[model samples]
Target: MPRPAIHQSCTKIVATVGPACDTPEQLAELIKAGVDVFRINTAHGKIADHEKKLKAIRAASEQVGSPAGVLLDLAGPKIRLGELKSEPLQLDIGAELTFIREGEPANDFEVTATYPKLIDELQPGNTVMLADGMVALVVESVSTDRATCRVTASGEVRSRQGINLPGVKLSVSSMQRNDIANAMWAAENGIDFISLSFVRSDEDVYSLKNVLKAHDCDAFVIAKIEKPEALEHLEEIVDAADGIMVARGDLGVEIDVAETPMAQKRIIQVCKEKVKPVIVATQMLESMHHNSTPTRAEASDVANAILDGADACMLSGETAVGDHPIKAVEVMSRIMRVTERNLIHEINHSVSHCVHPITTAVTNAAISIAEAIDASMIIIATRSGGTAWVKSKSRSSIPTLGVSDCPATLRRIQLFWGIRPVGIEKMASPAEIRAKISQWGKENGQLKKGDRIVFVTGSGVVEKAHNAVVVHSVE
Candidate 1:
């Protein structure tokens, strides 16, 4: 039997899959280096391509003897440019540009959009950001089928780059036809997590959940907090979704670039209070796409995210289509491990007023006990993985194990900070748990004769809520 890949760091790393590390061998290298979760960006690839990546991930997981969660990131109703007549068309300052609807006659200076109704949505003076905010255009005139604009910020524009209309209310549905199809495919493919991009409200999260429910898929729904509307309804959206992702790419474009740092901190703090796993994503190691190492500022950005209470920090281009995919994961893991060393006395989660009071109390007590005894490890026996989540939020420095029988639950908790998902027989009695963990501990060399272990479970409770904490000595 292969041993589970147990990581020492509390914060997790999520790496996006791309041509750089799509092979099973490359993925296995990433898994061994330290990747808690793999993100499949549905925006750039076909369903069949993603299917191949999924298969490679599964094979790599087995080869590495570790479990990694899969995140199916749905490309929501994104406004983007269509094929450009000239590749890498440079738009200088004060240049005139015309954005036309699909199938509309376009000249060399004119462009068409993937959304046919894009021209209709445009009005005079509306700001249009393209190529991830590198190029900016202000609507000068709106004619039938075309919106003539003047380029305020000039940069090279490419085919299929995203277009952002900041502050302009879009009529597009949050859940588009492609999103639904992708969600269906994700559910059918057993993706552990499905993230809805550009989530505007709790209803958007619920809508994705409903789709999964209809398909009998229990994959966790992650709401990507990118739009301004999502921030307006942050609390409700956090409470609605299974998890949250601070998607800072489009978010930076949608909101002021100056506000994104504070916004990222705010989102992580909210998830911490709400006890939902939050991932900080986008350009954490942007320069690493070409360079062998991350810039100093990028390293601090990643470390600060962990310090800000983010459960995980994600790698986009650094691991996807990068020159150093494995190196990026290794560097990220190293940063997390180093940053965590300073969080030994981090604040315990104060969520008594929120949901799962009983489970929260038990996990809280378990953390205190572990700290008091300087225990070697904390063991959270969970059924649906809620107890583990609570313990994870406590942010205890002690190494912890989330033991669950359900395969789905085990995979889902991979995103949780500080708590490693370990498969057990089932939620068992304290004695049974002790025996199993004792065997595991010794095999993994995590426990010895005098070592102490803290266990949190719901053995006495008839309901699913955890209500017990026990301390045991390895004898």
Candidate 2:
């Protein structure tokens, strides 16, 4: 079956692949609905399972011809409760519960935690949150093998639910042994991006980079800023990483929920200044997981992310296990379109002054010329896609058409805001490159007769170095 064309939405959408959208046909639907990237979460499935899904996603993306990217999320040092005697245990307010280090058959009041160093890392009066902060506990006493806690805010606590310690720093490496194996697998399999979870410092980013380099993988590293410590070393971490994800779920649990909005804005602003792609994730359309339609507040939340200049917005459980995954993506796309329409004034006011080299100035000047002349698109022929990335940071109203011969570069630019990646055969000269752009623009229906296009390209003699910009009319 032929897939329908999706509108060119500026803010990219990332959908997680799970039981709901695991098959190639289902993934095709997501691609048709405008998903820019498919995220494979290593925390839920085995490597073999993910390998199959990655194959399906690639096939589906090729069929749709969208060049959708794949992001492999590595499960970092996460703590969870062990098996329970029953499915869920209910605790009343002011009840006492003990968490043991060893796994055992649990009664109503006691359960096992997976992290063996939980007791040693935590002290009395420390707050423990369970089940995504639904249930809260205050520690009263600690023993060699167990920590007894009083339930401050009680609810149903399920087995294998995640545990969050607000201020306690656990003595664990950012990447576990299994995470390294998963990352190696992702690199060997040609994954476009790798998301490191629970990133604390710049050292964590360097460690993952070293692993990728050792494996000879070119996948971009995205640091998940979920811990408060990451906020303290934000600049260093951002400099070390290729991108950043505002993982609001764990961050909200670690800090006051009210502070997350300010933190998100700050992170996005800093990433824009650094020219790094930023993705706003977690609970954007949570209500649509079961319901067919999203609440008005959910729509506003997604729009606000786009308005705040995030490169992408992600859907976790909404696309992973939701009943209306396609509808969710459609809703998000519509909201992005509406929000982008209102951003022209702001984008014009906030011009990027990233004039480090001559190429940066040329890129900025090209965008300025495009915006002033109301050009249909800004066309860039890049070997490494660096010119397209610089134009995307300007946040121009015009869409960027990035032409590249490198498949990896095409896939990597799919995550950039307002950039449409098109793969082309290698051209030998400047005239050949211009002719190819015009041919692609006509075939893709992005340009019509007499339409103006701001074209930028690197020197034909040098690879991956931009030095030329011109405005051409489609013939």
Model 1 clash count equals 0
Residue 26 lDDT in model 2? 93
Off by over 4 Å in 1: 1-4, 344-355, 426-429, 459-466
Q: Which lDDT tens digits does candidate 1 get at residues 384-470?
A: 777787778777788888877777777787898887877766445668878878887787787788789998884332245437778
Displacement of the residue 162 alpha carbon in candidate 2, Å: 0.4
Task: Name the runs in model 2 displaced over 4 angstroms.
Answer: 1-6, 345-356, 443-445, 459-466
Query: Residue 384 CA error for candidate 2 (Å)?
Result: 1.4
**Every model: Cα RMSD to truth:** 2.2, 2.7
Model 1, residue 74: distance off in Å is 0.2
Whole-model lDDT, model 2: 0.85
In order, what lDDT does every prediction score?
Answer: 0.85, 0.85
